[model samples]
Target: MAKEKIVLAYSGGLDTSVILKWLKETYDAEIIAFTADIGQKDELDGLEEKALATGASKIYIDDLRAEFAKDFINPMFQAGALYEGQYLLGTSIARPLIAKRMVEIARAEGATAIAHGATGKGNDQVRFELTAAALAPELSVIAPWRLEQFREEFPGRAEMIAYAEKHNIPVTASAAKPYSTDRNLLHISFESGMLEDPWFDAAADDNKGMYVLSVAPEDAPDQAEYIELEFAAGDCVAINGTKLSPLEVMETLNEIGGKHGIGRVDMVENRFVGMKSRGVYETPGGTILFTAHRKMESLTMDRDVMHLRDSLITKYASLVYNGFWFAPERLAIQALVSESQKNVSGTVRLKLYKGNVMGAGVKSPVSLYNPDIATMEADPTKAYDQGDATGFIRLNALRLKVGSGVEQNAKK
Candidate 1:
């Protein structure tokens, strides 16, 4: 009899540890573990040894940070995709890349099925599975949390810890914290534990130390810091007059934005799984870039083109948030967004003070702000025609005039 090979997304955590052993016992198969290092800054240490000890036949620890920034984060940033205008889609954006690499690994490993640690109730389960379905429909997906048997065996975190201990799997689970977090290059999201209560004062000192990316506004330095951002074709290419790669730009901004206590949001967002979930996000670098990019657009982008792109923001954001990053419609929307940003090249100076981002100045060679045409002073040679407004106003008001007349006649 031939045993099936399964590739599991392992994190060396309690849930994944238990799932690793359980998959082996249940399937009687060869288990291959895969880990994607998308800037989970602290979680990558000693993962390979941990996976093999926990019943995985082998392990794959690939660094996907650079690809994550260039492919996933940049396109989302260019679209200005923010779920509910607050969340930067940090957690949502990272899942696709992770799943993408998993599918590739499955093919190389000759694995018949792929598995993830995402629970059924959250958006991640959909994100991981959707990407797999889009990329490799032939591969089977094993979501343990969604299965009746797996859920019945380990109903909660406590049961999962017990299972890991009984199996002699190395796990770092201890006295559980009130909240859980997911981190990547763009942002870190804290949810579930204490944050489930939307009324909890996250700004209080008790909750202050939970955030990794930014500091509390009140605790930040009183002095304001200025930073200059340069953009090319809608992507930030440099900072403070220095050219940098995409990864370097994010790292630099996270540092500077963290020092000044920027990019912190506490909001209750609508989860794609049809529930209201409260989350506190720290997107310091993303917040700065989003602001600086818009400032750059104001200098070079036309009003109608910008407006058209703006109209697509919410829909585009919804698609990303809902795990459709690989969908045809999302690609179509991105085409429109990319075309709109072709002229959005410039430099914007910003002042970061506490939690606020202020635009200081902007410069662009292709700036559409013609000072001569907008001047209040008289221009004899190319004088602006005030009389042009008469016909322009009349033509635009024609529909309104007819509508008003119809209303008055109906009253009579």
Candidate 2:
């Protein structure tokens, strides 16, 4: 009998590093570590060496930054997907992409199983498994965090560190940091440590150092910065007239938004697994893009169409957060959402000042706002007739009048 070859989604973090050794020891199998580079800044530095030292036979460090932005982030942005109207779903959206790539690598490597470090309680496990099942159902999936053996052997990060020491696995994490962080081009998120307490204020002096993407709002410069964002059919095409790739757009806005102390969110959200969790997110670029995109839509989108699409925001957002990025229903909704963006082409002017995003102006060649019809001033040849309102009001009030009359008669 031969041991199964497994591909592990490796982060080179404490959790994944421990999982790498555990998978090898438990299964006695060949392990190929895969790390997706979705713009985690310096986190990817020395990852290959760390993974190799952690007992991985082979390592795959793939750069998927542009794909992450254009395929995952931009489409979700186009759909205006935000969990609970506050969370930008930054960490949630990245998982499916990572899983997709992991499966692809598994097939190429001729591996029989794929593994992930996501815990049983978290959404990432669902996202990873769902994606792998959807794409490569034939391959076996391994989730070490759920296993009793892994839990008994390494109950917590402290124990994992000890085990790493015993095994001589080089790791950069310490229990002192306490919190867990996930970073990418769109945003950065912190969870499950001091952040576990919903009452924890990230703005506190001691906790302020936890923020990696932006400064505190109170520490931001006093001056206001204004910029123009140009859009083409719901996608941001340029910033202040400089056209850029999706990744470049995100990078530019992240720099500006971070400087202005923008895109910080703290909230307790309902997890798909039927529990509530507190999370702090820094979505600097995404915040700017969402604000600018909405303003652009206001200029170009029809009122009813905008309202209709707005109605689906909650469901669309939930689907993304609940690990249904590749689900059929999400795809159907995305189709409708994409269809609504046909005329969403325009420029939006915004002012960024101390964590605030202010809309300055919005204009579009296909704007539905008609000054001739909407103007309050009296016009001799106006497109709208004031006399027509008499009949319009009567027709609109008729239903209410009938209902009120029926109620009054019923009382008699």
| Model 1, residue 142: C-alpha shift (Å) | 0.6
TM-score of each: 0.97, 0.97
Candidate 1 residue runs with Cα over 4 Å from true position: 379-383
State the weakest 10-residue window (summed lDDT) of model 2. Answer: 372-381
lDDT of 1 by residue, 307-410 (tens): 89889899999988888999999999999988988988888999999889999999987888877777878655475787898999999999999999999999
Scored by CA lDDT, what does every candidate get? 0.89, 0.91
**CA shift of 254, model 1, Å:** 0.6
Report backbone clashes per prediction: 1, 0
Give RMSD to native, each candidate. 1.3, 1.3
| Candidate 2 clash figure, as a count | 0
For model 1, what is the alpha-carbon lDDT of residue 362? 96
**Which stretches of candidate 2 lie above 4 Å from their native place?**
1-3, 379-381
Shift of residue 25 alpha carbon in model 2, Å = 1.2
